[model samples]
Target chain A: MDIAQTSPAADYPATARTTPTRHLERAHYDRATVHAILDADFVCHMGFVADGLPVVLPTLYARVGERLYIHGSTGSRPLRSATDGLDVCLTVTLLDELVLARSAVHHSVNYRSVVVHGRATRVTDEAELTLALDALVDHAVPGRAADCRPADAKERAKTAVLRLDLAEVSAKVRAQGVGDEPEDMDLAHWAGLIPLDRVIGTPVPDPAVPEGTALPGYLRHLG
Target chain B: MDIAQTSPAADYPATARTTPTRHLERAHYDRATVHAILDADFVCHMGFVADGLPVVLPTLYARVGERLYIHGSTGSRPLRSATDGLDVCLTVTLLDELVLARSAVHHSVNYRSVVVHGRATRVTDEAELTLALDALVDHAVPGRAADCRPADAKERAKTAVLRLDLAEVSAKVRAQGVGDEPEDMDLAHWAGLIPLDRVIGTPVPDPAVPEGTALPGYLRHLG
Candidate 1:
């Protein structure tokens, strides 16, 4: 649909020219709006065609500047297909809550999501691979790149990383409270926002870990 | 790859004869698990093939028992293709937190997700359509079906609800603490787990809601 240039941010219906967000009007999109949603997520659902069918796989991802780097084993079908210069669809979503309204018909949720359509190219450059890997690691753990062992040559060769430039991307989000009909307000139902959050906890070391290897400073009070 | 009968739940290598977990691991067959994950979610990525290329759309979804209903108009490409008996991959995920570890390589996120592969059929039966609509309403509001105005015949016919029977579905979850290496444990770095949870807040009614329509009891303390 060439969603990159045509899809409008706050005006989803005019952009997509359809009713993809009919039920939950708040969960609609624009260009730059969707990019910000995608940036908040660390994993994505990568979809591709295989043997004349569709396949979707979940994998960890990292955003490097404007490009998305997805790593997997070279033998993985999705990775292999992406590396073969095939078209791929990448999606990231954050489910904020399960909205419960006074009236069932007006029930909805609050969320943020992004979908990207593009052709992924296999990353082969040694330096780019190193930097991408580092970015991924750092994204997951801020200062762990210097603490852990780097991927050896064999490890690097066995792993496959695909780069999908965020050229054609669209984001959609739904936030706020329920939309109940005016007559249904005093139906003796509770209505309000139940905020969902992700919090970091105390780390549990592997049972076989040797003593004296203290936790890194960045990991102490992380969210 | 057919994941229906493959089970190597113990971190073993994938083998041809491996029996996939018949219960928790077999993501495509369990209806309850699929509905549980879907009910708790707010967004999903619908993956399909268009013009010999792959495309993914981020959209809202609602679950009604064994059938998962996705709503859209009659003109959407993916919806149209699904109505034609094409296989579709729908994925829903909830990201809990960013796992920070002592070592970069050990960092990961705590998440729960479900991926389903099936052919979508256009909902045509009147009884099923009504039930699906009610389920969609209840999915968004725990006790909403009884409070709001029912959809008239015209409203029902205008909305296209695509039904994908719960078939081959699996839920993959990674939770708990970081996975630090033995040698990196005592490096004087703080290590712990970050907990992520979806919290439901008090519902807020639309400004135009009439007085005396109290909130439903189930929604008062919903999770």
Candidate 2:
């Protein structure tokens, strides 16, 4: 990611203080901290305003070198707005677990998230299109890019891919132990961190798979 | 839950056409589908317009009966705008898995999400405030409502809670096997469903916990 292009204050202001902000003293902004949070999740909620109205849409996304790619049909309204030079705000969150504490006020959740604000440009070049598609493949399944059939001309034309250079991005994360109030220490309440994780199960072969197709190495050892 | 107050277009438009219409599929409007998806996640990206500019913020959310409650400071910009009667868009998504397929076009992720558009009303009633807080707790950890100390008047006064009745909500979901094209089935590539799950881990006790506070039943059996 291009850390040099990112301006934290421009993307995340300290004034947006919600009650959650008070507990956000431990949140970090380092790139490694941010990317770890982003890489652990698979979906993002893209938010934007069109015609003076707030619109939030859920879409699939992949992180390539320094950019995030989002795909949608050419007919989708949000995609059309984004392709028309609109500024977009995108956010991805990975909810690690529910932090249960002895006190109600200290109760919290452990999560990691990245929020990026930028103008999205539609990917039109043929070379970039192929690369974006391949990046997306490897993003979901490591090493699957070379193994899959590449998109043909007709297929490429039907899909709309938008790229947002991760220029002004900020990552906010809350992890570790519960926050029990000092006075609640003596209360007979169960207070601890319930670590949450995303695990992949055994692959279920497609019923229509050819007689003897083998499972890929990546799938066999997916984290 | 007040189902009648929910969005009029509660069902998604489903058609076999290349692109589905805006108003036909159950995936678009079913309250159960929408609530299930919304309640399963922990955070939401809230979008609203300020000074004709778009802003998106990530915040924790809890669903109460038929309403979604999001807590922020009394002075927050988006919360202030929402209280001033501006329409806001709130979106929540749960990423289930990374779908790695043999074909590039078939690459996708399994997810469930709900997008709600409505005006947010600042919650003021003391009774409703307590209920909302408990609901928030239970939403994060099922059955946590009875385990923690109830919020007193002072704590409630310090918190700014806003409720957006679950009106005008739409749920969109995509789950199941990959959408590999017929010709790509024999491409000698691996194809199958990699299930994604959120697993809860062993609890970590708070450092300041009293000598012998035991874990509560709710914390022991969390899903």
Candidate 3:
């Protein structure tokens, strides 16, 4: 529940901007926390300034090593900004529970989030791009990269992969029960935590799949 | 599965920024689609342009009428930027399914997301602030605003609510089975969709709560 614990050896150095302005106690710069929050999810909200205004878009991303790879088309606006090395902020959030407090002002939601502030550059190296693209598909369903048909040369030419290093990264988390002032402890309002979990239902196969083909082990484990 | 169904009568006017450049078929501007996507989720990723760079933060939000309100501390950096009317982009995303395609390039996630771009101003009107604050709490749980203790004068003074009109908004969705090229359909890969759902679990009551709370009627309804 506490992400504030110190881990000097493996923690990412916190800069003035990444140190957090409010709730300083909830920020964690440890590498493990940052990677865990990023690896557990497949989608992310990428923020980049365009034309002196901020733009946010939800897209598919995967964390590989110390850099995060985000996928998009070559003509997409967000990805195009990174062609010249754009100053971007990529964020991933996982909501654990909803905290209900005795007072309205104290009401909060329990969540774990990692924010990366860096220059996102369009990946051009052939080897790195191949690895990043595989990580993206495996992020959604592990081990399926080898089973599926790899992108051909024509398809790969149109895809754009942006890489942002995990240099200025910080994880913020809020967990545990509600917090209410001692004076309001006796209030008659109901107070507690509503836990939420994401569950995967049965998979429906496409009609075109050949008969007698067994489901992959990775997906079987997902069930 | 189609969000592009046109309803020009109720659609928001799309400007140069809002009109999508890629995947033109999946973009939707109808007010009902935008409101539905916003109402079904409580957490959002807010993008703000600070110091000529983009910053993304995860926070709680609520939609009322034609505007969206976000609550934050008065000293928070993101909220402070809005004191003089800042340009912001707020996004809410709902993941529906994971599409497994025959080819790696075609792998995609089915999602419903709303993006709002406009000027965000700090709420100074007392009446509107009160309503926004209530909506913030109720967004977590219906009928929660009246049940909990309202914020006192001191608490209200420290809280800041930023209001952003539902203008320049658009909803983009990808909801369906896997989309793979006809040539790759006969590949030996398993292709389908893994449906995802958000299920609320049993509420965990705080230890300090009254022993005989009997769980409020609304909470019983949650179960």
For all candidates in order, state the fraction of native interface contacts they contain.
0.51, 0.79, 0.98
* Candidate 1 segments whose C-alpha is farther than 4 A from its true place: A1-32, A96-106, A175-194, A199-215, B1-42, B96-103, B175-192, B209-214
Q: Give the higher-TM-score candidate: 1 or 3.
A: 3
Instruction: DockQ each candidate and list the results.
Output: 0.36, 0.62, 0.81
Question: What's the CA RMSD of model 3 in angstroms?
Answer: 4.9
Better of 1 and 2 by lDDT: 2
- Model number with the top DockQ: 3
Across B1-223, the per-residue lDDT of candidate 1 in tens digits comes to: 1113223232222321122322234333344544567888756787777776776666667765456788766655666655567678788887776665666555667777877677888888888777777867666554667656666776676667888765566666666666776666675554555555555555555554465656556654632
lDDT digits (tens) for residues A152-186 of candidate 3: 89888999999888889999998868889999899
Ranking by DockQ: 3, 2, 1
Model 1: how far residue A115 lies from native, Å: 1.6
Best by lDDT: 3
Model 1 score (lDDT): 0.65
lDDT of 3 by residue, B89-200 (tens): 9999999999899999888888999999999988888888899999998887888898888888899999999988887899998877778988887888899888988888
- In model 3, residue pairs whose N, Cα or C atoms come closer than 3 Å (at least 3 residues apart or on different chains), thus clashing, are none
Task: Label model 1 with its docking quality class.
Answer: acceptable
> Regarding TM-score, does 1 or 2 come out ahead?
2
> What lDDT would each prediction earn against the true structure?
0.65, 0.72, 0.86
How close is every model to the real structure, measured as TM-score? Answer: 0.77, 0.87, 0.95
